[model samples]
Target: MTDRLKDFIENNADGFNDLEPSQDSWNKIAARIGHSEKVRNKKLRYISIVSAACIAGIAAFIIFFGKPQNQTDNFAEIPEVLEAEAYYTSQINMKKEQVYQMAGNFPELKNEMEVDLAELDTIMVELKKDLNDNVSNSEVVEAMIQNYRMKLMILEEIKSFLETKTDDQKNTTSYEL
Candidate 1:
């Protein structure tokens, strides 16, 4: 067993021979590693700089151009009001025309009804202006009530006319029979 161990040691002794690296080779290897590290650092620095510039540019855009001005924001917010105004204006205009046509059909009350409708128009304009100005004028409310009353009066007159015509038809039919 001792003889086998001695032989193994002798055989492996050559593997542990002093094989010192040459100075030139060592320097070359070190220089290559250092150059590669520098290149890698430079690339990382370039990427960081580019990323920083992009972030700065995005921030600048947000500060200067991306955000809307107050007036623009307000304008954007007014579509609801505009839509409501359009709807109200159309409704009022139609009502006005309907009232006028109904009044024209009644020859006896046409002039008086026209005068009332004119008053209603003036009142509506004032009411609209007051509403726009954020002033809750009681006069405007009263004017709206008056307009509603006038419309009711017109409808009453139409009903009376229809009733009279029906009565006249019944009378003529009774006479014929």
Candidate 2:
């Protein structure tokens, strides 16, 4: 079989040599290669342009809006509001501790108090944001101070209620004993 294949190939070698590719076919192949190369170059150029645009957009955003603001700096502009906030915050903390201590046996009451305080805190945060946006706006600063005062009021009310309930419980227990 090998000898037969070798003889067949030797006899057909001249026919194979005579069958050369046409000039038009060679030109078509070259054109396809060139077209694909052009498409690749176009794709590369588009990708680079988009990347540059994205980088420039990000840089502009950082340059325009990345300034850091100090929390104390805003409050420093209004010393009275700052002092009021500090006083009310300390008072609220003290009252909260007292209420929590008295409410150790009343989980539901404690939870309710916490929820009320949290709502006030949320409002205070919004007021603070407004104040920071316009430090010179006395209305916003007043609102912020009022928020603190309201928080202190709520804490005081809770503390007073708990103390009254504690006193009533002590009196009832003493009478029972």
Candidate 3:
């Protein structure tokens, strides 16, 4: 079939080569495609403008009607916690980092202490939840503050212990030569 088609093309090659569309026909086709592209572009521009306007209206509504934020440490409902929450939390984070770095040398000890610390953190979270629900639970607030202090002290002790162990290991290794 392909061979027959090839033979037909060869026979009609002169007629095919001699025939060409008029310039007006080419211009008409170009105008049709160009007009459709322009319409598509305009539609996209209109859609983008509508979307932007909708987003701006929603944002304005939120800004004008939203309540002022009052942040607390895991206690969103309490705003009078003396801002000590932020300070203690940051200190805990710094100590946690130190403990993590020291864990590379003392995995067993760090793991053991981490288990205890996790329990204390769980307790603190529960206390924070209580404060969120009540906003003025004296006992839970006290317990949470104590937990933070305990964690800080524990981290400091662990850091000291790791430093001493690392120094002893270095000294013992060096003296063997």
Candidate 4:
């Protein structure tokens, strides 16, 4: 039994030696696989870094320059209208004599005022048309503003007159009472 054990040990020892790879060969194979894995990892890392950098750069560009430029460009393209000025001027130019003549008499003056208001409505429609046609023109924008301003002024004047008339009526009524 001992001799058989010794023979088995000696045979298996040489068998294991034959099966074992040389140290240098094993090292080369290990190094090749390791190097390949390292290269793959490096390439992946580089791609990831480049992608991140590209995204960051685009974001930075949009944040720093794109949004404000777009806003300014949009605003710049919109025509400026001086509505208040136009309304005021138009109101001042309204002919009181014409209004009175249209009234036919004192009682009819209210009707005349209404008719005059209709004229203003016509003027507003024309101004809106002009604005639509010449939206790109600065002069047109200014004219529209002036026209609107005049209209507003006319409205204010009418409002004042109505208030005055109302006050007068209240005073007369109180005196009669």
Index of the highest-TM-score prediction: 2
Candidate 1 structure, TM-score to reference: 0.34
lDDT of 1 by residue, 100-161 (tens): 55444445445544544464455455554543443433333344444445444444544454
lDDT of 4 at 3: 95
In terms of lDDT, the poorest run of 10 residues in model 1 is 68-77
Candidate 2 clash pair list: none
Expressed as tens digits, the lDDT of each residue in 26-141 for candidate 2 is 66775677644345435434443443344334333433543444445565356787787778888889888888888897786677567666755665665565556643345455
Q: Compared with the true structure, what per-residue lDDT tens digits does model 4 show for residues 56-140?
A: 4433343344322212223223533344444455554464444443334245435534554455445545444444444333433
Tens-digit lDDT string for candidate 3 (1-177): 379988999999897799778869966785677644345435434443443344334334433443433544444445556466777889989988987887696666667567657756665665565566544455455656666676776677667766776787879967996
The Cα local distance difference test for each model comes to 0.49, 0.62, 0.62, 0.47
* Of 1 and 3, the candidate ranking higher by lDDT: 3
Q: Which ranking of candidates, highest TM-score first?
A: 2, 3, 4, 1
Q: What is the C-alpha RMSD of each candidate to the true structure, in Å?
A: 39.0, 29.5, 24.2, 36.8
Task: Give the TM-scores of the predictions, in the order they appear.
Answer: 0.34, 0.54, 0.51, 0.34
Which 10 residues in a row give candidate 2 its minimum summed lDDT? 54-63
**TM-score for predicted model 4 compared with the true structure:** 0.34
Better of 2 and 4 by lDDT: 2
